[model samples]
Target: MRAYNETWIENKNVVSQAERWHRRSLLTDDQLTAVRKAYPVGFQTMNGFLEIGLFIFTIIATGGVFLLFVELLSIDDSSIFGLYCLLFGIGLAILNNVLIRRRQFYRNGVDNALVMATTALMVGGFNSQFLDDGSLWQWCLVALPLLAAVVWYYGDTLITFIALAVLYTCLFDLTLEASFGRTLLPFVGMVVSGLLMQATRMIRQRAYYDDAVSLTQWVALAMLLVSVNYYVVRETNWLLIRSTLRRSGVMSPPEIDLPWLFWLLTVGLPIGYLWQGFVRKNRMLIILGVLGVAAAVATIRYYVGILPLNVHLTLCGLFLIGIAVGGIRYLRSSRYGFTDVPDEDSPDEFLISSDVITAAQVAAGTSGHDQHDNVKFGGGKFGGGGAGGGYN
Candidate 1:
């Protein structure tokens, strides 16, 4: 179901781990080189900045070509235009496949851009042709499957996010028509996000889906917090109520039902997240928990106005700094597998090294070179250099 070689993906993981070990002084330079040779990742990738630039260029080029083709053919009819879009989208999808299989383009900008363009054109074409008068949920329904298929094939994190958004839209839209839709909406979101988090946790051990699953877990955690957030629930409910009231010629300030419940959820959810995060030692949860607390504070200040804005912000900043200082001091000696010091075994070390090396290479004007060249730090074989050899 995947486009890239599974072995290559596994090898990429091995190389990343090896790179981390080498940075930690666990593996010598020669051993790192041997590891890279043993587990070669043949995917053609680019530096982060270059990837973004190329991605933008590919999108512009593809869109320009499509427009030029349409103009040259004088195709103006809506249905005809839709057909052309579908055709172009299919062509781009094929091109994407060719790039991945034949050219060995992995998450490089060109492939990423092609995949994105293909999804957009396909959805837009379908909408223009058959769903012109359809509701937004219908459009979302059309996109959900397409996005899921793309995720299955490419395992792209951005595409996964888009798919999750579409899925949530469809879920919420469908629920909105139920007898007590608005009241059930938040609970529904929470339940779905929780289930998704659980599923991702179960499957995240798989190397092929690791990145996608990890991102999904983070998103799910955030959604779980947002599902019952006071500000979101109040604003969204009021918007719905305002529309209904205006339709019925009733103009009054809309009030939310079960305000106390939302308030409790807003205050309690973050604490719960923080507790679970620490107990489980999950970094995503901890980060989201901190963010959730900040959001809750802002929500409270927006309504309560206990202190001046500047004063509140200053207090919050100082409080956070104090916590940071205290935590660092407390964790200096390590506690329950947690520490303030950097962990050499952490994957972040390898990522940081990769970024630094890529930046250095770019600054040195040595970004372009043959893959067969023996560069430093396992270059041309692993650790950000172009990996050679055919995909199995």
Candidate 2:
């Protein structure tokens, strides 16, 4: 908080917030007390309750504005749409800049969501401007570098995930469309991307990479799981030759039985993820592994309906229960990764806790990091890691 003028002192509210920021760092104690003493009374009550509602309000406000345009303007021209997207992008970028100028970047709870929404606007503008042809959405791939550069430069942690998601989507579509980029390539790509995020974070941890690392982990995991799940359901044998011929109008896509590899991966990959997750204490992998197991079973049951649903479900429930009981019994005197993890403040596990201040934690809690860094707290090796640690 740079003091731009002497009024910064007369304006005790900002001083108090600045002190709060200092406390969050957990650096000094007496300095905080002295600052509070100088600026006591007429406490600047931040409308945090109102701030909570602001997210919903921001979303609705954006939609309302767009809706008004659609309803009142009767603008159906594509050029007009392009103009609107460009104008909206410019407007949102300016608005975010305004907030930054007001020093509300980290202060306002709604800033992140607002900025992410703006990202969509910017991407829309890019699409309207560049993707004028009505071709496969694959053209969106060109926007990847542009959006990635913008997000990297903009320095919004939340936007990183969106950018990465777009990147992955393009990769997936391009791979699926092409004959060569099939089978295990996309799956490997996703898993590698996730692992790289973990590895990079470990090597270059810092305060700036917090949200980007946390959010992208989930997105990468999702891509991995979806790719693996698709492999379980379908066969990719001779895809290149087949797709090549089909593209040249030589043959149509053939109907074929599920490959042996599909079943092998369906059962094997899930167990592998589960085992790795348990041993490595990687919750993301464990979760994907557990869900993978269920999906594998469901896929099997969907294709093979020899038994009644009730009977299959009963057997599954009993099997899961047996595993739970045996596992719990085996580890009763010991410990498991998830067994000792403390509960987070947010029920929405997707959200960052420190970024979110519950009424209780807000009133009673002292300043501290959101405990998002896994190395600083409880987490698996691949989980959200501690930042600010220098790379070796």
Candidate 3:
């Protein structure tokens, strides 16, 4: 076997792109040479973007193929198009199976890309076959579960995150009539996610459920962040009234959108999550809390852009720099409230818990940057907790 530096592998786990790429600052000349020659990470390479672009192209290409197939069949009926969805979906699924079963690991990007395209086809086909009523809630009911099965079979975190997003958004849409559910969902999400996080800990204590742990943690943290961030973006009363009107088509009393209440939710709730993170020494909690804080700031910026853009950028930049320094200082100190008891089978999940993996990085000074924080309201797929392996 050819020797290569694994430092890049380790360094890529650092979330900040700066930290991952500027390895020359830390490594010696020999190590740098090794890093340069080493194979790029599967999901973390610059090629990921190229792969994404190609994946999108593939979806479009697949749709065109579906259309061409329909044309060849000469089916003039609009309803017959639904049949096309079924045909195309099955074809894609077959291809996905073949690629996964037969292809080399070097072509995982192609496999994963095909799987994503397959998901779109399957969803469209299922919806066309059954959801003739054009109800989003109904479509979600049919589609989310199927997509969930894809996630399980594929074992992809990205897919898992997507499913959670679909579930959350659809539930939000369905429950908008009650101001309480909308308000409570994300809060409920936080608690539920925290429970999930605790479950990861238990799994780690016993067996270190590599893929399962990573998937669970990323999902939980994403849930926590969504819960905390939603509380601030808008008043629940607005959603309540809108949903009620949509559902009933009646002369319902309008609920007022009180700005004052949102001000508290937008600013205070994140502080609360942050405080809870500090209290529990929960890394995901802290990371979500930080994201919640950023979301709050974004909410404020959206509602109140009183300052000039440059000044806004400058202030935000300064604050982030301070936060980075403060966080590093805190973690380096034994006062690191985010301490986990020394365990052999710890830190197995995706990088955030990636069920998101920052606690290990930000607190314990470890790096596993396979975190999937860039997603919200998605299509779930994963690859066993960003495991570093190639198809042999």
Candidate topping lDDT: 1
TM-score of 2: 0.63
Tens-place lDDT per residue, model 2, 1-392, is 22112232233433435444663675375665555455442222244455468666777887788768767888788777867877776786677666655643442445555666666776776677667884444555766676666555454555665567666666666666665556545455656676856765675644344455655665565455545543322434345457676777856444334466556766787788789888997866766677667766776666665878778878878998998888767765656445532333223331543344333224433222223233321223222211111010
User: 1-392 in candidate 1: lDDT tens per residue?
Assistant: 67777787887777666755776799997886687678767666466677889899999999899999999999989999999998999999998888888877877888999989998898889789888888778889988888888888888877987888888999999889788998899889999999998888676376676667876776677778788777778778777778877888867545577889888988898889889989998666676677777777777776776788778868877998999999999999999989988774444554556666455334433322111111111211111100111100
Query: Which one wins by TM-score: 2 or 3?
Result: 2
Native-to-model Cα distance after best TM-score fit, residue 383 in candidate 1, in Å: 31
Once fitted onto the true fold, the runs of candidate 3 whose alpha carbons sit more than 4 angstroms away are 1-50, 53-57, 177-236, 239-283, 296-392
- Candidate 3: C-alpha RMSD to true structure equals 11.8
TM for every model, in the order presented, reads 0.85, 0.63, 0.57
**Cand. 1 TM to true fold:** 0.85
- lDDT order, best first, reads 1, 2, 3
Better of 1 and 3 by TM-score: 1
Q: What's the CA error at residue 12 for candidate 2, in Å?
A: 22
Task: Kindly indicate the candidate among 1 and 2 with the higher lDDT.
Answer: 1
Could you tell me the lDDT of residue 336 within candidate 1? 90
